[model samples]
Target: MKRFAGMLLVAVGVAGCVSNPGVVKTGPSTYMVSRQGKTGFAGIAGLRAKAMGDANTFCAQQGKQAQMTNTSQSSGMPILGNFPRADIEFTCVAMGAE
Candidate 1:
């Protein structure tokens, strides 16, 4: 009883510690955004927003706009693995001069 509860708590804590989403620059104008577990499908809208925001920020640093070019999703193993993973690909395009 008590031992089982403790184990459950540990499992939940571990699950909560899953990796955070990240953006990886594939090229000067391309990037990939990805995340797992709660940061993925469990909170899909948040993930998308975060990914887009990251891409936008990166492009902004170089004076450009972030444009989403592709997206992907996958369901992982239950409990012991990431249940859902999300990925977004984006390109940075130069903003026209005002």
Candidate 2:
């Protein structure tokens, strides 16, 4: 049991080390992958919209989803220079979750 507790502590420490909202990455492309993992749910809808393949179509399709939120679009890429890449938010909170 002592060994197990030590291992659990180590795992929790590692998880805490990896779970920081400040650590984020970004990229640019016609497509958008979520950075909320890095950016937080602040970006989930935007990411979903990007993943939808057609921004307008995706918005139209998702407009009614209860979880969907209105997000603003920028004329230029938000993260990188329009290159397809991803962001990882190690600190993003898991919802209704443990």
RMSD in Å for candidate 2, one decimal?
15.7
Strongest candidate by lDDT: 1
TM-score of every model versus the real structure: 0.67, 0.25
**Using alpha carbons, what is the TM-score of model 1?**
0.67
Give the root-mean-square deviation of each candidate in angstroms.
3.6, 15.7
Put down candidate 1 lDDT per residue, 1-98, tens digits, no spaces: 99999988877786778875577878876799876665323765666677678788888898898888998776555565555666889887879632
Error of 1 at 95 (Å): 1.3
- Model-by-model lDDT, in order? 0.73, 0.33
Worst 10 residues of 2 by lDDT: 23-32
Worst 10 residues of 1 by lDDT: 37-46
Clashes of each: 0, 7
Model 2: per-residue Cα lDDT over 31-83, one tens digit each: 22232222222354454444333333332443421122233332334232232
